[model samples]
Target: MSEENQNQKAMPASLASVAAKHAQKQPGTNPLGTGLEARGVHAWFGTKHVLSDVTLDFAAGTVTALIGPSGCGKSTFIRTLNRMHEFIPTAALAGEVRLDGKDIYAPGTDVTKIRLKIGMVFQKPNPFPSMTIGENVLSGLKLAELKRSNTDDLLESCLVRAGLWNEVKDRLKEQGGSLSGGQQQRLCIARSLAVEPQVLLMDEPCSALDPGSTFRIEETIAELSQTMTIIIVTHNMQQAARVSDYTAFFLSNDGPGLMVETGPTSQIFSAPRDKRTEDYVTGRFG
Candidate 1:
């Protein structure tokens, strides 16, 4: 067989076109140092190592998708970025996750501030059960002890950005739990936005919702990327292609999860450098 066929050939036109959507999207004006960077990051849960030596950069005002199979540590990696991994009693991490040139794990660093600047949305929609819809959106400010001159405006702004303003605006006084699954996820997103985070980390943010909800969340992600950096972990390659500017693939050989490749979403989808990435993207294997 010729080299082209022996290895994975070019992507078919359909996927190429989907990827081409962001091919012309340029990086933000800020330097790399101004964005979030992971330098030789490693993670462990007591005796079990989950991630190894993952170093990636997420440019300012851009979206990056982490695509991999289950147990490859995609979720674990993102949790480390926001210091959420350490919340596990046995969890330990090494190396640096730097935001604006400072290590977030540095001595006496304000972990609460780091969490404030880097917001996280978990795998499921988790709006506070007791709070009203409007109250849920503005709860971050109260929990963080922040004072905003006009919470009415902030609530509307966050909901607008999350693409749920029109749907929930009339029912602001209703319980947050009254919303559907997808709407609840967006509400959680608005809750995160109330703090005005510089980076947002989403771990399977749409996995629990229906296709329509997933599409809406993707649109929200696209719009949000214009103002702040985003990192998402997804098992769905199509979602990665649709919402991300860059893509990173992680894999494991019965050991610690490792980043196999990283590049522009278009390039990663249409012409991945790593054979394993091609296999995974093409559905040949996980």
Candidate 2:
């Protein structure tokens, strides 16, 4: 195969791997208002640089949207939080990411343990087809080997928390693949919630869902934020405005990605501090 074909194939596989990771549970939580913080982070993929001197804080109990055009390192920056970037053979980083006040990338840091506390939901709803809705919800618990008094009660509570219990309550054993796209996404969300994570990362979660389903997921996110901090990556500025408390815009320069502007979502949208942010938010450029 040609080099181009190899790259194309790798892209999808990489995306799938990313999707699978998002479907699973991750690290525990940081307190509200101090969920996660990245300071002076720089990363590179061999000679291709990405994420230069990026710094931001993700507060607990609030939704923070990381938005930017294609090629920008919005996804790359988030992947670093749970050490997902380590999967890339050429990836390298020079910075510190803190969960609460502890450095997540510090030596001896258990990457998997960090992920268990910081759960992730992908842009597409990729629930395990072989698993039932109930099985999907319990996937993380079983994987974590955590003991529980009443699995049924836990299932009911998590499903409800993801705004899915009432919808699929009677059909707990139904195959996760049998649900509508929106419900499946919520099922995925419920699955992430089952592990009792402290922070949730959603990457363009509604991009593939219908407007109604997207609305429901947004509603679920709003409710979930009361208990868990959420950081989302999205291209839809309107959705960012509607769901996020703060917004961080990324821009891809000649090398990789850099933060263009970040602040309260309302201010970023209505009154941005940077001209580039104003232009992007106003549809001037992607």
Candidate 3:
């Protein structure tokens, strides 16, 4: 057998078209605003370049999945969108991440407001152990000093959107730490929803979860996408296919990670334009 034959693996059927047809039919425009846009984005830590020239359009009310191998800079790219990357002492970045047609990195922009419009849910569940489940959901409001009437309604709405309301509604006074890991993650998501962000960034939200938990998270993601833009970094191709409207593939070749290809989820899974993407989706290489 030759090397070419050895490299060929069975291609996955078009899971996106079959599993995420509803996502594809979602309205591309959110009544809130145009989607977030990234152009010529790059990132570095001290002298080591991590990401290079990533440009993507995340339409409002849609889910875009960043699919790539570990260390391809998927998480770093999303961090830059909301200025979280600046928190790193040695982190450096270039290019523009625009929201509502304005550059987020513009001088004197309110960092807090940017974050309010673009929220993040991390890989690990980090609900505040000291706070009760209900308090944890509404913590953002107090921390941001934004006042609202009827706290109970907001708590229930956020929890409902996060798909954890039924299970935790009776347990609202209980500490967030008391919940299982899956419930804790959903609680963290509910916490993010309290402020009502227009865009949400999820960095491998389901990576640490079991199958049942992962399915619940995916369901939450689908519901969330109907109102706001969502960008998720996922290594699970099936999840990406099942949840995202669009998919971006990233890779690194002895240098900075680059966006290899991006397209509608169905097309990316069925007929990727780049060989590298096909190779990765076919399990020939990362």
Candidate 4:
């Protein structure tokens, strides 16, 4: 057998109990109606306001696309969802970001724990080069201090869940960096899934890929939505229209960024309620 095939055969199985628990849950009803909710959200970087009173809700098992012109705070806003903004010394926020009806910023909440429930995929594919494909898929579990015997099954299951098993199954021992750009991105997605997050945040996941690779990522996103809530920040208007169930438009005039319009993808693309949304989506204005 080829080296790749041998590596693939050694992959671990999926965690049937874990996968089943996640799958058995009904789609979209997180007890909060929204998997993630940002209410009265206001953000600032030192003296500069970045996000102003932004409010949005991402339903579980659905794709919510955040679209806007450059520097419109779309990426910043999504980062805030996962508490990534806290790393910026100048950043500050006043609002309620809830996951499953629980306030994320509350005093008792552990940011680390919160992050475990909310996984993020960057605009770039950032697989750890030192790890093998199997290692990458099991990276999350390595830190949990749990008994790990079904390594092969878990690796296979997570890769399959990320829609990447068929492509990389043969090379589980190969360095994660060895894959094509698109496959690496899917590997990153698989890595995130290995953690079993309830919500996934993606920032321009396909912007760096060719059309074929982009299509593959989109397919993965669509399949992922069957069990995970996905929030995507993409500058590609057509991508948003093609993959998203709902769209949120952001714009910044002389003030901080705010949502100008948000609704079904069809309406946002076909008949936007706001002129700014129409302009941005129709190539009339930025």
Candidate 5:
């Protein structure tokens, strides 16, 4: 057997259990967790093209990591998935972004609804300072006009799913910003979960965190992948290999960012097909 396959076989018993438990829950008819596809996608800020003809598929209930050096357009491409790129006044894109086979950018599509289905967690921990922890979790639901009879249960469940409930269960009323940086990031995750989004977009979610906190957030990602499609952009290759099922390597030279290769995580790390991908993975270059 391949070295990568052997290593995967030797994963810790606990982690294997976590993967087994949550991995089979497909997206079903729910638009939130459905598979996503980008076909011949190109993006530009005014006339400056940043991403060119990027075609990718993100399987439902799996984690796909976008990894590369800085200025490679990894972040920009992720933002485009949920239509966040449009927030930039000069930004525009071509090609199709499909959610469960339906084009999200089609005429008459509601941007707000698209965002609700695909939630984002930023690189830094951003919990609203003005709101309590409980309030923050419920904030998305409230904004979406989603009324649940069991608000308290919803809050607790989301927090629990985020792996933060035990830490802050008794202090839900505390200001969200009062928590430590790690706790705050988890809080942001809980807020995203409360909205029950199908796909979660994380842009270097652990970059600003310390080692211990980064580990915790990684655990949350693994657990959450069972229920939603997760696309993460990270410069840390180790984290990408550890958490993602699939990996895409993006590269940019004098022109727009382009995908060098993508495949199963084990294959990408063990035997990358492209020389550029091999160089980046082997620490030969960025």
Candidate 6:
């Protein structure tokens, strides 16, 4: 395929009309400002037990960074919070993930609704390659079957929240893939925000970006944390220390991944109570 054709294939198509019919109805009210809690969470992929007895609380309006070595279940634990782990045929989780004291895993709970309340941004910028910039921002609302009276307003607000409004406002109809890598990632973030989620999960959202893009994403994260709970999985300890209010350290060696310690970001980096955490943060060991 030609480079232009490949680029076109990379950008998701417009979903404005679909979004208009079912855009996010509630845009003004902040649905998120509530804390999230995980209790005794354990996870398995097929027959391989990956995480064990993990528990943590992400306070409302705070950024919590999950840090550890590779293969330590940081991403697995993040997925479990929004129930994304269950997408795997053999994946299983045993624990309670609570949002504002309500158990998300309770019997009869709607998984779709749970996901809407908890939005996720993956490690790579996966904006719908066929969608326009504006359409990409409103795609989540369409998926959630929500309708808003003002889609234009919703698009602009979400893009602004993601720090992409000024840069892309003039090209709302442009393909999402037309933007730079940093812009595409921000567009993904804008798409997530359009759903009005209470908790946002980011699994290494900046891993694919250059340093400049990483800085912009970090800025966006800082801004978003003012109104929503954020849980991020990152291997960059410095990034964790720079952007997170609280940090949790995960480890795996002889057994399943486990939480070694969690505390304020400053405390965890400056004076970790656990030797494992100390070693990881100090670059002595991962």
lDDT of 3 by residue, 16-61 (tens): 3453464474445568688899999999999999999999988888
lDDT of 5 by residue, 55-109 (tens): 9999888889899999998999999999999999999999999998999999999
Candidate 5 ranges with C-alpha deviation above 4 Å: 1-34
For model 4, the stretches where C-alpha displacement exceeds 4 angstroms are: 1-33, 143-149
Q: For every model in order, what is the number of clashing pairs?
A: 0, 9, 0, 9, 2, 10
**lDDT per residue (tens digit) for residues 1-286 in model 1:** 4764444355655555687776434676643337799999999999999999999998888899999988998999999999999999999999999999899999999899999999999889999999999999999998999999999999999999999999999999999999999999999999999999999999999999999999999999989887889999998888888888899999988999999999999888877889898888888887
Which 10 consecutive positions of candidate 1 have the poorest summed lDDT?
A: 1-10
Which 10 residues in a row give candidate 3 its minimum summed lDDT? 1-10
* Candidate 3 displacement at residue 101 in angstroms: 0.5
Please provide, for model 4 over 223-245, each residue's C-alpha lDDT reduced to its tens digit, 9 standing for 90 to 100: 88878888999988777866777
Residue 262 in candidate 5 has what lDDT?
Answer: 90
Instruction: Give per-residue lDDT, candidate 3, residue 88.
Output: 98
Among residues 3 or more apart in sequence or in different chains, the pairs in candidate 4 whose N, CA or C atoms overlap within 3 Å are 4-170, 8-169, 11-152, 12-152, 12-153, 13-152, 13-153, 13-154, 14-153
Sorted on lDDT, best first, the list reads 1, 3, 5, 6, 2, 4
Number of residue pairs clashing in candidate 4, backbone atoms closer than 3 angstroms, sequence gap of 3 or more or interchain: 9
TM-score against truth, every candidate: 0.95, 0.87, 0.94, 0.87, 0.89, 0.88
Off by over 4 Å in 3: 1-10, 14-23, 26-29
Which has the better lDDT: candidate 3, or candidate 6?
Answer: 3
Off by over 4 Å in 6: 1-34
- lDDT per residue as tens, model 6, 109-139: 9999999989999998998988888889999
After TM-score superposition, the amount by which residue 35's alpha carbon in candidate 5 deviates from its true location, in angstroms, is 0.4
Better of 4 and 6 by TM-score: 6
